[model samples]
Target chain A: MRLAVTGAGAVGRSVVELAGEYGHEVVAVADSSSAVVADAGLDPEALVTRKAEAGVVGDGDPGDALAADYDVLVEATPTTLGDAEPGFSHVRTALERDRHAVLANKGPVAERYADLRALARDGDGDVRFEATVGGAIPAISTVEDVEPGHVTAVRGVLNGTANFILTRMAAEGLDYDHVLAEAQDLGVAEADPSFDVDGTDAALKCVILANVLSFGAADDPADAREFTLDDADVEGIRDVPGSALRLAAEDGRTVRLIGEATGGTVRVAPRLVPENGTLAVSGTQNIVQIETSHAGRLNISGLGAGGPETASAVLSDVGRLG
Target chain B: MSDAPDGAPEDPEGADEADPAVDGGHDPGSSTHTVRLELVDEPGQLLAALQPIADNGGNLLSIYHERGNKTPRGRIPVEVDFEATADRFEVIVGALRDEGIAVMQAGTERYAEELTLLLVGHLIDTDLSDTLSRIEADASTSVADVSLAAPQGTAEASSARLRLEARTGETADALETVRGIAEEKGLRVVAPLAGVET
Candidate 1:
């Protein structure tokens, strides 16, 4: 399959760099400002180097690459909130033209899911977003395999930055500010870190999962309920002091920012889990726990974020489309 | 036993000395007893009847007080379930009778289930004892144990871990009781994942 990639970020560059090894060709690539389009396959090294040194992928208009001939459009742009624009528009263009859209952006799926579903239904192409939930863990696909109707609930430690901060605080007996600073220095958490710690990021991911479960289980798509960030009951770890963790630890337990999504609701909060439990993943790691009817509880754990880690999920999504 | 009156059971010994073994030989370690009493439909009558059970080291399990259901004498019927040693069970019954409360029946019963959670906030300022008393007074729930950590001082934010033993199948009601208290006090509660034992 031929791929047209957008947003020259870490994930986009990694997808372009690794597409060849996966037996796929990158026909067009675009960043915010420029685009490089070729009827034949473009050179991965040249495009990445141009993006590095020249700060642009090519001289063509970014819209030109959207019009380029490709089988799948990979939307790896930074996620935006309401409307989820540029990324949503990019996906819409691909589906409108009967081309598949694989997304690494959470905004489109988390915010505008019904719109994307409507487009996918009308067009001949399919839509799959395995990367939007858990980076390298096969969370979305596993839920799909179990068949959403049979699954009771999907929950996990979805945010690595929040988990890292909590883990360090419990281990070192430090306050939230002190451990968050250490996490920022180690690059485990962003400098701003509001989205990760304030529970918005985790809530968004759980909202996406709730959308999948709700829509997937419904017999008719129109009758299914759609979830957005506003529907979630979210609580962050910012107010969780060291004393809380200490109190929890004394009873062989610890606090983690756990996000849960069922067909009807979405909630994220600091919950007390056993000290060495499966959901108590240490450091920058993630775990997805699925409760199903036929099959018992299933747990999937791995790196939740990174360039190649997330890009791998995108490429596998493409492979699934074929 | 079938022909006995509501407030009085037919037995050789007095109501307080009813045999635990005769009610079906339950485990010897501890046994639960259901004691039915008649109240005068007064304000402190229910509390007056329950004070003896708690004062005599009985683990109160549940209290089914139907205000609308009254005896022919205009007295209210209240059934209380509690767990205690065989000797303490006798002592509690004696205490209730000594308080001028009628004892309808005392027989073996069973109660089981426990929930653990954490509360985070200015617990000292909010009157931790009052918070606990309110929880105990709300439902058939009792705070089995509590561990408080006020490392930063009593004025700052603190945390408390509470282990509650509730009647079987009443976990949801017990949690709701705690959540209501926490919300009113402006505190945060970290509850365990329900039905998922880690």
Candidate 2:
């Protein structure tokens, strides 16, 4: 299959690299600034080097990649709220052209899932966004596999940055600020880490999953619509006092930032995860727990976000297009 | 472990079927052993104590986290029961202590055989709860079932039938605890029942 990626960030670069290793031809690749389009397969290595050296993937306009001859359009751009523009438009363009869209961006799914589905239905193309939620953890596919319409709830430790800070704070008895600084230095957190620390990233994933559990599966007769991030009740880990973790620790409990979506309601808050309980996962690890009517409770855990880790999910969705 | 927590198990209907250990459903290739650790009531300490069990290939059967019960060191006594091959048990225990956790005990738990005994004494004069506790302390013994025939009321002589599960080799240890309590309370002990002479 020929691939066209819209965002040449960490995840996009990884997808290109792995696609080459897996023998998939990437005919087009684009950064926000520029794009490289080839009627023949584009060199994945040259694209990576060009992005690093010139800050642009190639000299061609991104419009060319969008309209390029490709079977799949890989949307790996940053998430935007309101209309989820650019990523949304890129995906829509691919779908309108009867091309599959595999997204690592959260915006298109969380904000415009219904519209995307409608567009997909109107055209011959379909959309898959496994990387939007649990990176390479297979959260979306695992729940979908367990008989459609049986999922009662999906809860998880979705943000690895928050989990890393919390785990370090607890283990070292350091304050949140101290651990946060250490985390930032370790590249575990972004310099402006408000999005992750404020739980917006997690909320977006939860909202997307909530949309999937509710609006996905055309035959289920469940409401087919998007669940915007605004509908989620999100709280960040920024204000979780070290004293609170200490107190819970005294009771053999640990604090974890848990995002839960069930019954049309979604929330992200710091809660008492039992010390030895299944939710007491440490460091940057993530766990997505799905409760179903038929399969009982199933848990899947792995790296929630990373270059190769999240890219693996995007490529898996591409392979699945066949 | 403890019935898969309060709300975790999917089946509410057959949730209380039986304990997994007693059902002989446990893999015969591996045996059950309980590790006792006193953890500082800190956030990651429990995870710290439990990681080695998983790292050493010990499958956790149940965790008896005595959060309310603390040692003189102001730490909680957590008993984690797990299944591992005999060879891995030592490594698991070593890993637990190497994490700087206090391992109170780590050994095979054999409370499988059942034994019944009779104790006759003053109904309420001596504390029955204390007597029962002592009979179970540091021994592979648990009161599986009990019957008290106290027709004469709380102030009179009452005999109690106690059915206990014990490690076959450690039956004498359990019986000794009962005998010690019986001697202190001047209670007549009639042991060695017909069917449970072992």
Best by DockQ: 1
lDDT of 1 by residue, B78-174 (tens): 9998767778887987798678676655553322566889999999999999999999786667675678999978867899998776766887899
lDDT by residue for model 1 (A234-292), tens = 99999898999988887778899999999999999999888888888998899999999
lDDT of 1: 0.88
Clashes counted in candidate 1 amount to 0
Can you write out model 2's per-residue Cα lDDT over B108-165, one digit (the tens) per residue?
4445455556566673578787877777675577664455665547755665666666
lDDT of 2 at B178: 82
**TM-score per model for chain B alone?**
0.50, 0.45
Q: Which candidate has the top score in lDDT? A: 1
- The CA lDDT at A259 in model 2 is 89
| C-alpha DockQ of every model | 0.31, 0.02
Per-residue lDDT value at B95 in model 2:
80
Cα RMSD, model 1 = 10.1
Q: Would candidate 1 be rated incorrect, acceptable, medium or high by CAPRI criteria?
A: acceptable
Q: Name the runs in model 1 displaced over 4 angstroms.
A: B1-111
Q: What DockQ would candidate 1 receive versus the native complex?
A: 0.31
Task: Give residue B106's error in model 2 in angstroms.
Answer: 35
